[model samples]
Target: MASLGVFISCTSDAKKTNDKAKTVTAAGDTVATPEAEVGTVREPVDTAKYDALVKKMANGDTTGNWAGRKGPYPLAGAILPFKRIVVYYGNLHSKKMGALGEYAPKEMWSRLNQEVKHWEKADPSTPVQPGVHYIASVASGTPGTDGMYINRMGDKQIDSVLKIAKMQNAIVFLDIQVGLSTIQKELPRLEKYLKLPHVHLGIDPEFSMKDGSKPGKKIGTYDAADINYCSDFLAKLVRANNLPPKVFVVHRFTRKMVTNYKNIKLRPEVQVVMHMDGWGEPDLKIGTYRHFIFPEPVQFTGFKLFYKNDLKKAPNRLMTPEDLLKLKPVPMYIQYQ
Candidate 1:
């Protein structure tokens, strides 16, 4: 079952308009230009607390980390609030040849590689390039799954993704199902790919159930311990490679997906983002962000607009150039079909 909590200040509808610019309507209420609503800048986050959190993670300590932090906005840095043009490259199975379970053929691989290259080269003036996050398949080689039985396409898949990242200098997100393995256990295997400067991590908590749990069950819950394990490992790996702090992406559709989520201690050096993957209408997208996302301390947030699914339901409300601009804490990443 899903749970809801009210922790942050609700956004008011009182339009704060500028004398110079035109007003706009967002979330059913007319609002002034974004610049007019800039209230007292939120105080800078306490760096001392952030420093202590990093030390605790490095030492494998999870205690007291959750005690000090509060709900909603725990950290700060709105300089580049997330934008809404992010694209999520999910479903590698669709890129495979023949039957759904068939191995991804060389032809399919080449085609996908070329397509990604094109996206990388997309004009920067267009909000499509450099911001695309390619999600690698986590269920590819797992036994008993539809994608299993094929030769393990481990580094081969990683290599293809890296090529796009290097070509566009874009961020590459490694998606992990963690079906049967713990995050720690899977880290070493992915070290070769993770060491790349552009690579980041995406955890599919839906498939991170403990042993004996059924698939599609409400199984994965990221507690302080789990987050510490992830942060510490990635921090060390990134430092060893002399790369910038790694981005850790967590997916959540309902509240239960990330129990005690607000308490997860993260390193300041590492960028952590919680993405709401509730796919459906554009209005649903707006509501989700206003109700669930505006409260979180995520460094960035993502929105997925289905080229086919979205067009089928509310063809008129499909996200447009102007609609994309109004997303609060502008979406850092936008996903397409």
Candidate 2:
């Protein structure tokens, strides 16, 4: 991770004032005021260039040559008002793999690496563009279980994922499943990746547990204080890096997962997108969003469709872009399982 700091520069000018009441000036000569020293003005970034880049991204055309092409596509202004949402659920750790069963013991770590390679190779047909954001689980083991924390792949994995994201032009949301650990404790360790402009944070409160309780059974709820701490830290981190605002993702299934959400103070600099991760029947999922989330001021809501679960239900409502747009505050991201 690069050192987080703001860059500032100053320029100075000096001017002399004429104290004499009588001034003999040449014809057509204007008297100049004593030069007062003025501070140097920082040059503004080429916003037009940035806008053009954004337009290219929105049009799904990330082809032009750019000078500083490092991480994922800059999503500063690419996100539209009522665009469809796409959410991805997966972990880098082998033990906590996705339900796809594609990754296994010996190959789990290599799987993500290989997946990124595949994604890069298929960028022309299936680019990991900005419309879809990838959520990589940092904490290993089960969602609610406590276990040893490891980056396993270290910086190599982080760089690999970031490069893939850049090539695909997608955002990376670091999913933090806080188990026995507090949000405060886990944040610092994940700060390395969060420093990246393309990276954001996701909180799985379902996995958050009370001081002394069982993991799976304990459904932790974040009070205003907890949410504030997380948001504030992220906001500062983003500002320090001179990057665009970071999006904070909160997953909610049952009401208990997010209690007193109305009271949580959202930081102006940070975007708080509340997602409904309820996976089940389509009607039931819609009902959950309508009853609990629609009335709130959340910017976005998320719908998760299980390949096996939702596919079996009656009517088999798999949420499409059209179904999501009908919601009051349309979901910004849709999670596919």
Candidate 3:
């Protein structure tokens, strides 16, 4: 269980600079200096060239879902096809959670930087964007007092990751695994940080547990409505703050994990990525992306690589940037855990 301090601010000044683009990372009892604006936040999305870019992002997919009938023209600072985002995903508390937790800070950054170079070399046309994806809401083994079975990481936990990303001027993603809770209840809690331009969001449907079962006992699901709720939530924040577009990520490995793909709405303020979160040998992983992710297109596509799980068996190997770029509608958002 989290301590009482988890709900409270870690530092007195943490909340003071939150609503601006220049927020700070919390450190012990004080916050760091105000953050410099990161990423291309103010440049408006060009409607004159938007359609051509989305078509290029399609990479020859004949499916009618490429751009997916958008509900809003994107605001300035959309970073989808313009540059590929390579991210490290994990929870900070446990090493087993992912690469972010498995290695010391120095080693983790070295490994991540190596990946950024790999993708850049493989696809020179699309510059690589660095990002850190932290699991802000983890699905726990036992039900907590609220019966949500979720372990919510608070101000200190989030501040730690933000501090690290600040070094490279990289983006930060706060992911959610709702367990028995709903998106409506969980997302609003992080508004203080989400209001910033560089901090984005990701939702894992595998642990959603919509039917009231324990999180790990079975894979969970999220319908188009749940996804729409998050999009609307982030969209409102963007309009209110005049910040850059937030890249909203949805994790998927199965068809049921995300239902009614056609009904999920897109807004100018939010860029939705339907990420392939499955893990396996090359062939199996490729099949999962083709069967589940490729067929029903969202606004953007992302691929997740498992550092350990992908190499567990014979012929074990990780997929290289060159390997992923070969797919139809190449994934613009790449995640490693």
lDDT of 3: 0.80
Ranking by lDDT: 3, 2, 1
My TM-score estimates for the predictions, one after another, are: 0.59, 0.62, 0.88
Per-residue lDDT of candidate 3, residues 1-337 (tens digit): 1111122122011222334355654545323322223332455667657767667667776766564434567777778767899999887777777888778777889999999999989988788889899989888876778988888987988998887787677889999888889989999999988887788999989888889987777889999999999999998987777667889999999999999999999888899998999888999999999999988877789999988789989788999999998887789899998
In angstroms, the error of model 2 at 317 is: 3.7
Cα lDDT tens digits for candidate 2, 1-337: 0000110010024233234111122232222211111121223334565445333323332333212221233234223221233444554332123422234323433433444444345333223223223334333333222342212234544444454444334566666655556777777766866665556777777666655343444555666567778888987875565445577778776777777666776553466767776666778888887666655544445555555566676777666545654555545455554
For all the candidates, what are their Cα RMSDs to the real structure? 16.8, 17.5, 5.8
Q: lDDT (0-100) at residue 155 of candidate 3?
A: 91
Per-residue lDDT tens digits of candidate 1, residues 105-142?
A: 34334533443354334422222333334434343222
Query: What do the candidate models score in CA lDDT, each in turn?
Result: 0.47, 0.49, 0.80
Better of 1 and 2 by TM-score: 2
User: Which scores better on TM-score, 2 or 3?
Assistant: 3
Off by over 4 Å in 1: 1-88, 91-93, 96-137, 140-153, 217-220, 312-317
